[model samples]
Target: MRHQEGLALVAAAATGIQVGAAMVATRFVVHDIGPASLAFLRYAIAVLCLVPPLLMSARVRFATRDLLVVMALGIVQFGVLIALLNLSLQFILSTRAALLFATFPLMTMIIAACLGREHLTGAKVAGVALTVVGVGAALGERLVTESGTGEWLGAILVLAAALCGALCSVLYRPYLARYPTLPVGTWAMLASVVALAAPAGMEGLFTETSRLDPSGWLIVLLIGLSSGIGYVLWLWALKHTTPTRVTVFLSLSPITAALLGVALLGEPFTPGVLLGLGGVVAGLWLATRTPVASSDNDV
Candidate 1:
């Protein structure tokens, strides 16, 4: 197998970091609006971010059958994933939600192996576990202290979101490799709009839509823009590497959030941050190690 897959892991880590920042950003605004409504605005704005990329580039044609597949997966990724996440947030702190959702790699590993898409490797599993532990360390305080409403319910909800996200990640790989990132990402996000509409409308999102202030709209826009950018990066990574490798990078998100807090919110770096960072680095190192038959190392 031809190598050059390292770039994909980097891209995946970058995607994780970007989404991590978005996660932190969401905490501020999710409380101000309903989860369904917030999700609606996020993807709606995400679609807008895709406009320039889809427009300026040469159009890439997709087979009608494949396009439908992309749409179905998008509904799961953007609609189901975020819907579960948002619902979970209603019952727990965002930090707690994030820690639980970090279990995505475990789910991805199981799904990928069961589907015969990737082999089950000890290194990969350990990497996933390491990252999850790192996330717990990084957010340990908030995760343990939060006794919010339906905390277990929220944990269960986010875990379900992780499952949906894991499946979507693995399922989208073929389509992402077959199509251009901009169009594929954009179309997938577009499909989610329909999926999101019913829930958002039922949540009284439409009635409350007009109530958001300028600041709230800004938060929504930022989240949307990040979602669009993050989607493209994620697809790019998936196009180049094994699904397990991509999911392993998700452990980077909590670390990214902690760092962002220091840089953007004036928080102090602590011993926990250093410990978590070590785990993240160790996890990535193991996750990216070339297997004995790995094509990338075939020279």
Candidate 2:
């Protein structure tokens, strides 16, 4: 049991680091490619990566009903949610975006309660409030200093992405209950690729191929690899942990992004940023500590 617990901790930590690094890589890719195109390539490459394992997995078989549901999840999760999130970068700083997305735990809790999957408790509510406060504290400086239509628009886009992501999380419960994690993840990724390919192709696929410098290619590759591997780890972690526990780790993304900015982009680490990081950590702990059913068993 002790060994198993340690393994779970390692898995969760790995998932968090991979996801954080993926976000940084995604930011780099977006510096070169447009959000839609970046999103298109992400899902496309992810689908390609998934194909081998999917073909070999015995759990790959799906009924028509399951396929449709998976397709819908892909549309909302990978296609729409990711696109909106990428677009949000145009208006918001990476740290701010990460902080805002950290609200996923709160959103998940509320949605689960509404769906009768969890009870609404005062502790959960407090946790949600703490999370919001933490995120606000972390990004408060930027919010105060930054003023523009684009910034506001970016904030709205990210919030919208959060809503879509929350919906996807809730909707995935049923399919996860019926299917194994890898197979479902593979199909969902395929569906996202199919959905994005139509519009992306019409825009002239590979038009930007000539424009990519070595660094751009490296960033794209990182995005692809990180997203593919990180998502798989995420699915695996979901299978072994609770939703709140899985989501709480997401708060680390902003902190990771801040560190990355300091290391890679030469961005300064201000006191406000540090304070915000503390808030985010506190909020995540509070949010995850609330009593909730483990939704991960099904996934």
Please estimate how well model 2 matches the true structure, expressed as its whole-model Cα lDDT. Answer: 0.70
Q: Tell me the spans in candidate 1 whose CA falls farther than 4 Å from its real position.
A: 1-4, 263-268, 291-299
Model 1, residue 246: C-alpha shift (Å): 0.9
Which candidate achieves the best TM-score against the true structure?
1
What tens-digit string does per-residue lDDT give for candidate 1 at 1-299? Answer: 33547677778888888878888888777778778788888999989988887999998889999999999999999998888888787788767776788899889889887877777778888888888888888876766666877988988999999999999988887787678778988899999988899888987887654666788789889889888888888888787777878888888888888888789889778788888889888887877785533432111
Q: Model 2 over residues 1-299: C-alpha lDDT tens digits?
A: 33543454456557666666777777766756667677788877877887788778675567899889988887788888888898898777666677678777678768766776656566656766675676667565765776555777887888899888777766776776577877888778878877877666654555545355898877777687677776766666555555555655666666676677778989787786678677766765665554445432333
lDDT of 2 at 118: 59
Off by more than 4 A, model 2: 1-16, 147-149, 207-210, 290-299
- What RMSD does each model have against the real structure? 2.8, 3.0
- Candidate with maximal lDDT: 1
For the record, the alpha-carbon RMSD of candidate 2 to the native fold, in angstroms, is 3.0
- Give the lowest summed-lDDT range of ten residues in model 1: 290-299
